[model samples]
Target chain A: MNEREVIETLKMIQEEKLDIRTITMGISLRDCADESAKKSCGRIRDKIRRVAGRLAAVGDEIEESYGVPIINRRIAVTPISLVAESSRTDDYLPFALALEDAARDADVNFIGGFSALVHKGMTGGDRKLIDSIPRALAGTDRVCASVNVATTRAGINMDAVSLMGKTIREIAEATKDRGSVGCARLVVFANAPEDNPFMAGAFHGVGEAEAVINVGISGPGVIKSALEKIRGSDLETVAETIKRTSFKITRVGQLVAREAARRLGVPFGIVDVSLAPTPAVGDSVAFILEEMGLESCGAPGSTAALMLLNDAVKKGGLMASSFVGGLSGAFIPVSEDLGMIEAASRGSLSIEKLEAMTAVCSVGLDMIAIPGDTTADTIAAIIADEAAIGVANNKTTAVRVIPVVGRKAGDVVEFGGLLGRAPVIPVSRFASSDFIGRGGRIPAPLQSYRN
Target chain B: MKAIITVVGKDKVGIIAAVSAELAGCGVNILDISQTIMQDNFTMMMSVDLSGSSVSLKELKARLNGIGERMGLVINMYNEELFNSMHRV
Candidate 1:
């Protein structure tokens, strides 16, 4: 190599500190189906435990040798409801418990696929599992659940949508002290995909093999730093640069994940090129918007910034790896992103603005810390709002908000590390309990009318 | 033949300048180049045509490989068809 080129590559490597985000093993539990819920749950748990026993250690060893940090080691099993067809009495809680046990045994932080793919028509098992979501989440600590109520192909499922609204309310009521802490583990999706590796939404698609290792990479700070360099550059140049930067970041993730999967003797799954931002000062999607010339994250140009970032991230990441899936775009979590928190605290960003941003990005109203006394009905209203966006747009969107207990406006809670910290932003003082308390579900979006 | 050459490795300075200089020396026309500098990593994709160049694809690949080895880089070369197909999706 030429001396000049060698030096340039070395400098980038030295300064960038790129690493892999998560090595998620997607395992299909389709074969674990049985007429008996207990037997099926036992088999499903055993299969996961046996197959993923060595996943974490292998990933760690590869990380040590390759000098790439594999931050999270997780598993995404088949949708639990698909195997609960035989449970006439609704035994989804036990299944969830079993999956949580498996996650503990595997020593992983989270395991996805406690889900139901009922975007078209609800099977008996799907209906049963949906009814049990509140119990499943409240009874278990680490179990996450997702329900796909709409899709571009089959249209939206109003029955499922209405059910989820009630399910969310039940989840809140079950964990009222934590402001619907159980709801934090649930996601309602539209156009939901099978290969997403992110939490509360990840699942093994039907087309996947027995098992494979996928990675989700995130670094909003990296993109924000690059944008800072080309402050005066033209819009087109800015777009091109964002794409190029995303390519490089995604390449690092691809390489690290490929090496990790290879070391573990598993097939490489995907690289979720999501720009997951943290609440750290410089590492935020909101920061990227500000660097792009926005006064605040929810300013007038927020949606445009999100659109450009999402497109560029996909264009660049697609070129870096073929196995790319999940919500491969910028994340706009208010509480998790330092800049967004500041914006919210300053009254610049609002729930309405954040929902608008979700039309472009993946996660909706993420890590948002609301007032401790926010009513369950209000939280349901928020979920319905985000779900409407997802349904209309035919995209996968999730809400992972924390209603900090006893925390009022201006109060800040420190989650520390990747979960980050956020200031408790005030919601509307008026209670939406009357609207949310109405037990009936909102009708499906107009887009869901396809036969 | 026209081809797209992708060089991926630890991010270091001068990789682009050196790669571009090499293409210029060979009388090759560089159509477009995109580069991103990430934390501790550098990735680049360059499109070049060698219709009038003296070196064959094999020789060009060998030279690039040598350069990559010396710089701790991984170099991959693909013809137009392969390049377009890999990114069609």
Candidate 2:
């Protein structure tokens, strides 16, 4: 590489905070199914241990060799609802425990796929998994649960949606001592992607290969810094800058994903070009939007700016990698993003604005903390609204809100580490219980007839 | 295989000599070298061929990190592919 190129690349890492957010190994647990939940858990643990034995160590080795940080080494297995379906257990807590133990043994921070897809309808296993979410999440530390309540193809499952609302409340109450952290581990999705490498949403779909390596690339800081250099540029120029920066960032992800897959003898999946932000000052996606001339993240032109940002990221990333999947857009998780946290704390950002942003960006109301008194129906309503947006737009969207039990609005709860801290944002005081009480599918939109 | 070794720290004597000695000790051949001093801060970049190195990249990195610690410098060694993949296409 040329001297200027080398210097720029080094600057992107050393100063701009460009890094691989996650390298998720998707392991199919279909073969682990057993009639006994005990036997099933054992098989699950052994399979993960055997497949992901070198995951953390290899991640460390890659970080050292490449001089780029791989922030999370995670695993996504086949949805537990599917894997544990044959097991004759009413409670799936053992399955979650097995995932947690295997993740601990493999040295991965989180294991996803404690999930059920009920967009169409719920099976007995799906019902049991959904019911077990509160206890399962409360019982385990590293296991994440996700439920798909709506899809463009299958429409919205209001019954599952209503159930999830109550489930989220139970999860919050069960983990009340820990600031309702269990809710943070639970994601409610609409049109959720199978190959997503991001947390609270990742799952190995039945359509996927037995094993694959997926990477999530992050660098809102780099894009923001790039835009900072071209201050006062036109909109087209701004879009071009973001696209070029995203291309470069995703190239690193592709390289790491390929290397990890080769070393682990797994097929390389896709590189998710998601501009996932951390709580660090410079890594916020909201800062990138603000840098695009917004007064704040929730300003009038915020959605327009985010649309430009998200589209450009995808356009650039599509060219850099052979395949691109997952929620490959800018994530606006409130607490995990310093800029969003500040905006929310200052009252410039609201849940309504965040919901609007999700229509254009990646994910839904994420990492947000709400008042403890917020009812289950209200949380479910929030999920339904976010799901409607995803279904109508035919994109991936998810909610990972934490209702800090016993905390009121404006109170701050610290989750520490990568989960970060969040200020309890106010929710609508008006009741949504009557609407949520009517349980049936929100019929598929006309757009679903495209095929 | 090739890698880039970057050193950044306060300017001091024998920084290059120390870094080069460590690389040579591991049988890593230096392909190119660039050095500059900016505002009393020493910054050096080297392109080294590690195909003939006796140690693995991880071991070489650990050794270089140890040397950097002892010399009070911020030393980083990265595979050349990181730059190529990012900057090329």
Candidate 3:
């Protein structure tokens, strides 16, 4: 290799926050079902340990060999609602605990599967799992839960959406001492991806192999730095610059994903080339927007800027890997991004502006904090709005807002480390209880006519 | 297998002699060396082949890291594929 190339790669790693965000092992637990909840829990733990025993060790070895950091090693199993159906139990708390125990034993950062997909309707097990989410997230340290309440083909399940609002309030109160941090470990999604390698939404789908390795690569700082070189570029030039940097970043992801899968003796899954930002300085998707001449993130023309970025990242990543999937676009989670946190703390960024941006960006209403007294109907209304956007546009959208207990607007609650702090974004005080009270389904939009 | 070694720190003498002598001791072959000084700081890049090295690649990295510590520099050895995959394609 030439000296210039080596120096550039090193600078990207040391200065620009270029790294693989996660290496997730997807394992299907469909066969671990039993009539007894206790027996099912036992089988779940043993299956996870046996399948992912060398996962973390292999991750460490690859990190050393490549001189690039792989920040998290996690596991995703089939949704527990399916596996626990055969068990004659009303509570799925034991299933969540089993997954947490297996995560600790396998040396993974988090385990996700305590999830239910009730996009159209809810089965008995699905309803039980949804009821269990509040206690499941509060009780386990390393377990994450997600509920998919809307899909483009099946339409929005208003019943599940309304229930999730109450579930989120319960989670916040259950873990209120920690600034409602439990809510950060849960997500409500519309059209959630089954093979997502990232956090609270990842799950091993029914059609996946027995085991696979999926990698998530993040480099918001890298793309921001690239944009700095051309100070007065046009919009076309800005898109071109972002596309080139994303290509280089995603190639490394494909490499790490390939090597990790090879050493672990599992088939390699897709690489999620997302511009996921962190709380660290110089590591934010908002900075990339600001670098493109926006006064600040969420300012006027913010939606246009985010649209360019999201499309360019996907185009570049699609060219770099033969198999690219997951949410391969820019993520604008407020608390997790430094520039976004700054903008929100000032009154420049609001929940309303964020909702508009989500119509074009990757995710929706992520990591925002709301006042404690906000009604469940209001939260459900927000989810319904976000779901309508995803279903109409035929894309993925999600909500993970934390209603900090005993906190109000302009009050900042600290979540420390990765899940940073957020100022409570004020909600409209006007009630929507009447609308949410009439629970039914929002029929599929006309866009679902692809037959 | 091949690896790239990079040294970055304040400029000083004997940096080359100390590094090459250690590489020779491990029976490693040096293919190319590039050294440059800018703004009173030292940066050196080396391309090395470890197929015939007596010690493992991990051992050689540890030895180089030890030398870098004594000399107050930041030294790193990375697999060449990291560069090839990102820059070549």
Candidate 4:
């Protein structure tokens, strides 16, 4: 390219506000597990601190060098449930506290992986961990938690799902003065991916190497701008515009991941090309999907609409980056997407339809609001069902469910800012403990094969 | 002296470990390495200290080129000055 072309390209990146969304360091905490919970917790804290100490500093240096903003520097560790398995009754609280301290020492905004796998049924340890979620989240400022309760292979664990529903309700009541917002940091899942870098969903997948770095990029503005330029254009043109826009966005992500991996001296992990939406207006992935001609975010043909959007995004992103992974699709987190919120407010969307849409996207039942009196076992069943979807399809999935205390359907609970607000969506009153009580690992699927 | 090593062409297993091992044999201290795969094409950059090498620049390039030929790779080398001018903003 000529000098003028080079100058113009630089200006485009600078002026367009294109920035790297996150640089997440994945730490393996398998080494932290010990027979005693206190010893295990201590090792986990030390491991996180030592391995992640220079993460923010290194990320900032690269951000300055590249002239791109690396918006967040974070860490995802091996699920704490695995590490905290040895906790005695007296040890669980301190173990959670140790995790909080680790995040502070590492200077990371959030430390994910306070999670458990209970798709089929809860083990004794899993039950204890599930029960401790409210205390763990309330006591810790930056530690995030998730639980998987469903998968296709084993079906949803109604028992665990029921438990989570009640747990969410309790946490909401416990933190009602804080807008009943304690569930903001918790996620439930079906088909949870092993290498997600985003949170309330990220955990060091069991398949990950000892340590690595994964990156997720967002470009809702880029896609929206592309759509805006071609106003009144036909659906094909809109789809084509989104495709081309996603291509450019993914190229930037590829460059950022390569440079970050080089600077950090770690292996380059996947680039999740998910069009993650925030609370801000004009940046919702669902809005872009809606612009492609859905009257509302969730309506008849919504799942098909979502499938097309998700497929086109992967097609464009795959062309731009060879290392694409980590739930590379559109996220339909209701509250975070302004268009979805508006649709829900107007009664164009509902909880049942959202569950149906989860069959195609990266998450299930995310940022949903239910009543305060919902039973714990019902929530557990929901998680179990979502896990079944993920396990069945061999795809990553998650749930960010919120139960608003004292808020019924049609009532809105505001979380403010990027966390957004949600209208209480009704849930089924029935419980599912009998199936959930059948405890065992769902056998690996028939199609599980690397060769 | 500092030097830059560039590798390009098709990607295959063991590319990174093999090249780094060859550099290690020369006692070359590697400062950094960046690698990416675009489609079937592989590209890499390695900054290394060339001091104390028994081989001359031409010979080192020839040896690296030979390794590349054996593995269907392309190899190139640049002086420290040129490398810095190209990369340093």
> In candidate 4 chain A, where is summed lDDT lowest over 10 consecutive residues?
A1-10
Cα lDDT tens digits, model 1, A113-170, are: 8889887788888988888888888888778888886665666565565567567767
Backbone clashes counted, model 2: 0
TM-score of every candidate relative to the true structure: 0.76, 0.96, 0.97, 0.76
Give fnat for candidate 3: 0.83
Which of the predicted structures, 2 or 4, would earn the higher TM-score when compared with the native? 2
Give the per-residue lDDT digits (tens) of candidate 4, residues A1-451: 1223232234334444455678888999988878778788889888888888888888887664445567788888887777777656533666678878988887887788888887777777788777888888877777888887766666666566667766677777777777667788888777667788887778898889888888888867667666778988876776677777677677767777877778777888889887888777666877776776778878787888787777777887888787888778888888888888888888878877887788887777788877766666666667666666676777766767777777788888888866798877777867666655664445645555533
**Which CAPRI quality tier does the interface of model 3 achieve?**
medium
TM-score on B-chain, cand. 4: 0.87
For all candidates in order, the CA lDDT equals 0.75, 0.92, 0.92, 0.75
Model 3 over residues A1-451: C-alpha lDDT tens digits? 7777898899899999899999999999999999999999999999999999999999999988888999999999999999999999999999999999999999998898789999999999999998999899899889999889999999999999999989999999999998888999898999998889988788998889999999999999999889999889799999998898899999999999999999999999899989888899989999888898888898999999999999999988998987898778899999999999889988889999999999998878999999988888899999999998898899999999999999999999889888888889998888888998899999988964655
Which residue pairs does candidate 2 place in steric collision?
Answer: none
Q: Highest DockQ, which number? A: 3
* Cα distance off (Å), candidate 1, residue A145: 1.4
Best by the lDDT measure: 2
Question: Candidate 1, A126: how far from true, in Å?
Answer: 2.4
Write out the backbone clash pairs for model 3.
none
Stretches of candidate 3 exceeding 4 Å from the true structure:
A448-451, B39-41
